[model samples]
Target: MAKIEPGNGLKSAESRKSLRGTTESLALTDGEGNLFGSDSELNVYTSERQTDKYGFIGGAQQYSEQSAENIPPEVLRQREAKWLDMLNNWDKWMAKRHKKMKLRCQKGIPPSLRGRAWLYLSGGKVKREQHKGKFEELDSQAGDPKWVDVIERDLHRQFPFHEMFVARGGHGQQDLYRVLKAYTLHRPEEGYCQAQAPIAAVLLMHMPAEDAFWGLVQICEKYLPGYYSAGLEAIQLDGEILFTLLKRVSPLAHRHLKKHKLDPILYMTEWFMCAFSRTLPWVSVLRVWDMFLCEGVKIIFRVGLVLLKCMLGSQDKLKTCQGQYETMELLKTIDTRYMQEGFLVREILELPVSERDIEKEHLASVRRWKETRGELHCKSLPRMHGAKAIMAAEPPSRQDLRQNPTIIVESPLATKSNGEDKERKNTKEQKNGKKNSSPTPVAAYLEPSEPSPLLKDAALLGSNQSLSSAEYDTYL
Candidate 1:
């Protein structure tokens, strides 16, 4: 018998070839050297391997293949040069060209720069730097048993068709588990929500574990606060807001949906909660996400409205759907063929819906929510287990402080109708006894009396300075 030393180098090409042949032969063996499986099994495994290599199995593959083909080289070069400039002079660019940044994002973030762009746009890098080593700490420690099982159950369900999460105990699944588990430990009050799984999965595809985790945090906290809380009041409120917007944008479709007893709750829940990851095609979903990070939650409402119009805008299509089930099926499985990413994004941008429109509706909807269910508080939730005392002692981050600075009320509430002007003038008179008022409407929902601090935080984070009604409106 040959003496085989473990880790000894194969001295020649012939030796390596022999080793390869031996390994291949062993793959066909059943304990001994005889083949154990049928040729069909071997062929099926080989075919799957080929598919994994070349076919678009999931979002990552689909995005890479399609994005490469769709983005012209000249456009890519122009966008890349612009992205480099923005990143190099981030502060200046952000301060001076913020509106221009929104337009660039709407055009579509180049694939090469998307990860870094997203980190900057969501302020994820700042948050990650602030919380260095925190993820590892939470990851090493055992998570609360309460959320462990729930997280585990939903782990495989997210992007299961994707190569990253296809296998049990795969690297992608493990990373997802760690991220979600760490979040539960980080914010035990919110716990784990099913919708967050897909959102995190999408982030993980673009960035590393730590960055992905913080991006998820920014999303839950700043972009759509109260959305994943115990009551899910944000989602419920947004559903009403969506219905209201639908009435304005497409009254016929809205009426058709309403007539069938279909509410935004039934169709728009997953759309808003997961940021359309579950509903839109992966390509369109990525496009939406690119804008969502830069522009905040307004993109979500825009995409939702566009989808509703696509599905139910046409009387012919609406007539084909008989009831709620049929309508939902149509909405859920929209024909991606017609709704190509570029077309859908264009439609969203062209839609006359403005930030002010969404903000006004959101405020009214939130008030309605509070009236029915009392005030919902984010601070009422418990802090992380061991970090509570430290969190109390530690001073707030500059970002956090900036987010909560003294509110500077803008004057002269902007009004479209005489009734609204009268209402605002009366409110202004009651508060300050003034006749002349600013044109921008006061987002009274943002007043301190509201229990959702996260909503206020969102308004602040979206702006460079103190939170004002105008900046708050930009959040949509």
Candidate 2:
């Protein structure tokens, strides 16, 4: 066997070859801070590589003479300039893209570069410039009634889990409401949908109001097509496809899951609703979004597939459980932090496609599956085959996934039993967050002489002041 140097040298020849194509060296400086390579040497190296990689089919001089290509003279000139710039910064750009993926935008994409970076990834630089003025134009418009109504329905229901992070009357909530209401007025056809809140909130961390709104617009119109329809057509389509992909990636887990009547729909609904809000940590979700912008909707599927692969290892540990609920109990305990850290964009690219070798084929199959399901030609649905819950008559909506600011109040009751039952329910809710439907709970069974905090708050908000003691107990 040949001896090998372990620390900085190649472990194997294959590893060296793999790195050769995509990797480049950092610029070397001598002890006295002098550059190593001259421009001529750098130019020669680049010219040879470009010829090998992007294959020149014709000579530029020959093409210039014979061209009836209808290409704009400016476009050709701009293309040449871009090629020169790329050659100049080839190593730096690749290094940055790699470093970006590793660092994972936790502190958020830098402010100044955010717009340009987003534009580059989504190929919307030119389009963004064309419509940049629209932000000011749209800001002058009145708020949409539809958005008001939709916002009303879900505002109180926002942030129903943690009191430390409630959405009630905060600056974040105010900004969210303003942008969402504004966008609804601006684009009446799309109006306001649910998932935009978190996306907007995330954007707001780095950008200003109008900028975040436009970013939201870009994500909605360009990226997540048909995501917020009344029928929830896009979410259901993605859900089915995720289930199919999940089954293939982990056969044993899939078998166990199926046997226990599990499906992706139950747990994975969060993945689609808030786009990984409740599933992954906030940092990981941001990391996923970085790729999501660059790669488009396909990254959603790729991330979902990776998540399912992560979920697979627990199935065996869950096999000895008593029932589906126990299996779910176990599944919920599966740590996702490792998967989120381990699976980078490069690893996602390398994930084995169980159905087809080509990405286009996988996407086409998913699209076809969605269309067929839409046509209702494939009406015979198989029973769930894993440890999962069947979604209720109404699946989780996009709005339910975001935090909003609204309040819920209970009505007064005459009957003693009804009043007592209502009070217990309200007390529980006051401790935890509000229910998805209601804002705050009422303490209905307070003593006749006692004053209630809710009643005091309601009174401050300009409600009726006069009430008898007996009725006041019910009202509070």
Candidate 3:
């Protein structure tokens, strides 16, 4: 047989080539390296017998190549549409992503995009880096000495003050301070608000200083307007707003509150001032913040309503403890479970939409108040943001305070006794970290049935009465 050439061909041809080539190679070998060359009758007959034997492997490769080249048209079309949609409508997608990022401030945004996403969503994303440099440059030459002093004073008092806050930081206080100082440098206008400190600390857990500063700016300017204001009116307005919402939703609770002379403002002031950081468990506050970012400031009312409603409804068989201090200890111990069940987290979750309704109702109510009080309502009063004028003039008697469900304003006569004494005592204890013999059991005295009559009536008392820290400070 003639020698065969090796080349890319089907199996039948290759097999023939193999046989001829075998013979040639055998002929060239030495005796020691023996090779089989003699072809028997079965060889030539069988070689010619199977021409199509190799077709299967060739067919498989061809089919595979064809499938790769010609991917299904619909799948390709769908993928192209998705890519085009992403390209054309990227901003919309980005906005939704940014909103999600804001809500997850506790977990922090991804480290890589943290700065960009924060600034962009706040409408500063594009200029965040540039603005940071500019602010730093300005801060070196332009920050006020007074602002720096104020910022320094407040830096440590911000986050992790309670055990609730301390649990959040794996990093020591030093890292938290550096981020806070850097932020104070970045946004000098805000300088450093009280609530910003805690919020910034939380942001630092997940972001760099610059991003945290801008995030603080967004919080102050966009989410909480009053917090940044010189007078701190936003918190006051919110307190007034919470009072109004409670009255509308739970009138029975409102009456009980009025009778006892308990001021919703007293307890909730801390809540609004601190954004619930000091009020609820730290994690619960973060959960509220998640909704806050998406929904805005009105979540404050939802939280307040839920809390007040919880306190009111659950006091049915509440056992009385000892004096005011014991009463307060008992009040503080009320479990949150029942309160949570009735006030739907899902409903609260939907409050960004609910807030629109609240804002509209709020605006209308303001208009109605003005219309009804036309001549008596002075320009200064509406702007004053005082709770006294908004509430009823007289405080409830100890008995009236018990029967009414609404929280009441205290009357002038009720505080003739030593109500301010308890306030002073508590203030001293708070300052010294010593438990005073006399507890200003405001929480205990604020019986769900008996609204703190002193609070409702206190509005009518002369200006000579002593004030709490929150009273003169105005923000809380």
Off by over 4 Å in 1: 1-69, 377-476
For 388-476, candidate 3 gives per-residue lDDT tens digits of: 11112222223321211112324444443457877677788789998776433232223222224345324432322333221221101
Ranking by lDDT: 1, 2, 3
What's the distance in Å from true for residue 446, model 2? 62
- If scored against the real structure, what TM-score would every candidate get? 0.68, 0.49, 0.47
Q: TM-score: which candidate is best?
A: 1
RMSD of 1: 22.4
Q: Which candidate is the best by lDDT?
A: 1
Residue 202, candidate 3: Cα error in Å is 1.2
Q: Candidate 2 or 3, higher TM-score?
A: 2
- Per-candidate alpha-carbon RMSD to the true structure: 22.4, 27.9, 37.9
Superposed model 2: Cα runs more than 4 Å off? 1-116, 123-126, 152-167, 320-323, 327-336, 339-350, 353-476
